[model samples]
Target: MRKSFIYALLVGIMVAWGLNVTALKILVDHFAPVTLTALRIFTAGVVVLLFLWGSGQLRKVSWNEAKQIGVAALFSVVAHHFFLSVGLTRTTAANAGLILGLVPLVTSLLAMMFLRHRLTVFRLLGIASGFCGVVFVVANGDGGLGHLSVGDVYVFLAVLAQGISFIMIKKATVEARVMTGWMLVFGSVWLFVLSLVLEPGGVSSLKDGTPSLWMIFLASAVVATALGHMFYNQAVQHLGPAESAVFINLNPLFSLLGAYWFLDETITLGQLVGFLFIVAGVVLGSGGLDDMSARFRRAKVAAGGRKVGM
Candidate 1:
């Protein structure tokens, strides 16, 4: 696949995930957070499994691959979702969104330490710019920096777990779809077990859900969790972790928009400016500017050769 296409898909994934923040916020009101997360992940895992089976892509993993997938699921799905769902209950979506924006930085740091990925000056600048953008949006939002809540800590833990998972995903030898499917399946199982221990009444609550709530749940599971993660995992395979993660900076911008549309939240002028910083950050952090410059230089050299030949 072309890099441009992968980047575009990443952006789409960000949109789905950004809107998912609001969807999750809505669903949490009607269902227990851990139970809801388990159900959502299980539903998404089934969809992916069905697709893989139909497409002749489903196959059993070796013991080694299974182990890798298991570890990855522990971090990516179980831990990440556990923290995120629990955190959302205690904190504002805006706060969660801002905290989630730190994923790229954390992922990059992990990549550097574990994967030996170099931290280029461009990437450093991009990370800084992207983080600053998130700060701007959150700091300028309705109640800027209004005391850190325990929810914020959970969300931050979610970010760290997800970052580590990305590193594992990058290192995995299995196919992206296969990894994603199994990871979700395994993670959901763990989450369900946790829910049983901590939220014994959670599953029963689902029976009382209305059609609209179920609709939101399915949308979150299918569109956001299933498709979004599938695409993201594929992108990670192609682009590597750090470069792909830089795109996550757009999450807060999209989250801001999602909040405005769904939650009737106000958008501030500072948030608009933050969007610019985020765009620049993605471009720089992802080495997009470097690519453009190289292309331009190559074109110029070709043109000069043609002029001499003429």
Candidate 2:
């Protein structure tokens, strides 16, 4: 019961993570890519620092732990978020999130190589399905991309960067303590510098008033960036990213839902198909029919003497 509950929470976090794509897109007019990303990481870092201080774990991180977290910050939070945010600025978040769903497949491959995780057939198929879905998105649901828009290509690169990060997170979260706090602090500082370098008007832009300007930044900082990644980090520690990667499938789903609420975007059949492909990929990556069947049995047992009442 507790496991299921935690799983649901993880799924919720991933949904928020997915929804953040649209939220950032809405905010892009207010801040440049680096600016918003810097804000995102900095806010999350501050919150996380306060959290560590409160928990009394701030002083517990060793120097070796610091280095691991630093690497995690550079790859997962700094590099990945910068690339993805900049890419999301160019493409619709709807398209970007769907494409980024390929992260699991990429993570799976990287895990096999570096982490010594075995590559199961199911995961391979999921990876393939994810690529197929990407093709559909690029092709506009016809078959494949006829020609690449610079924006589309950038978005795809974002997907690759993020996918690699996911794999790294799976490993770092496994062995490295203070992974979350280190990532938050270092990533925030790096991003803030990047924002300063890239943004023409710099912090002065924050004073410009659109109705949701600060609200957008705050929500992204508090809800989407901090809370979302916090939940994800915990889930990785608890669930191992192999199972947890399935939670990422919720991203595109939440992207659509959030867009409907915030941007009044219409959902389309092609996107729906894209969603299915991602789901298919995740299911495959999750270890296929045999693995899912076993999970069902476990969940059923974990449900206890009660029949789950579902």
Candidate 3:
């Protein structure tokens, strides 16, 4: 019963994380790239800070932790959003969803090559299967892979930065006493600075803008950014990153679906097949092989223990 309760929490948080993509698409539809991003991060930061203050968590952040937050802000929020928001302007959400699916594969590869983490057959197979699905999604789509456009490059950069952000966040949490809200706070500052210079009057004008659009933006800030991260942290505590990473597979699904339903885009049959392959790969690489490896190790240890006893 306890385990089942934990799993339920995990699944619920994961679903929230996956569904955030839909909110992101809606955000893009309503405003310019960086302009929209400045508002989102700034608003999200405010909400997170308020939550921290309310929970008595705000006073715990140290200067060292502040520095770590600054670093994460640079990559995770500042760079990632700047690139991704701009990229989405040019790239269709369908293709962007397919491309973003590669983030976990990139994260796994980084884990193996840099973190020296175990790359069990399960991980490798999941990565491979997911990669193939990405390929299918791309091939099944209409655009040629010219890779020349600034937007295309920026979107890829965003995904890569996200992978790097995951690695760095793991490292930072190990080294510093940090608050989760701190990163968003610093990110909001960094983005705001950029907005001041490049997008003058953009964020300011938003204050006097349409009430309905403003409400939409507020929902995104609260639900998608603050609430989403809150739930994700809960999930991480319950399920661990390995199992929870699977939930991210639903991100693109929800994003593309939003594009289809709200933005009135099409989801081709090929993209559906592509999704299947990628999802299968993620599942397979994530654990089927790890289970086999663990079983083999147990058998080996038992055999050695018997020999030692004899």
Q: Each prediction's TM-score against the native?
A: 0.84, 0.84, 0.83
Tens-digit lDDT string for candidate 1 (1-310): 9999999999999998888988988888789999999999999999998888998999999999999999999999999999999988886676677667667666766777898867788778977886787567556644575654677778889989998998898899998899899999999999999999999999998988999999999999999999888778779879875467667767877887787888886666876776677666665665555566668999999999999999
lDDT of 3 at 281: 71
Clash totals for all candidate models: 0, 0, 5
lDDT of 3 by residue, 1-310 (tens): 2657766665555445444555566666566658778778877878877876787656765677667778877888899888888787776677677667667767777777778877776677777777677666656555644334555567778878888877788877432223456677678778778878877767665565577767767777787777777667666666677766667667667667766876677888877887777777766665534655678999999999999999
* Candidate 3 wrong stretches, greater than 4 Å: 1-6, 146-152, 174-178, 204-209, 286-310
lDDT of 2 by residue, 104-205 (tens): 666666667777866777777877887777766666622336664455677667666666665665555333335665677788798888787788776777
Query: What's the true lDDT of residue 53 in model 1?
Result: 94
**Model 2, TM vs. native:** 0.84
- lDDT (CA) for every model shown? 0.83, 0.71, 0.69
Model 1 Cα shift for residue 246 (angstroms):
6.7
Which order, best to worst by lDDT? 1, 2, 3
- TM-score for model 1? 0.84
lDDT comparison, 1 vs 2, better candidate: 1
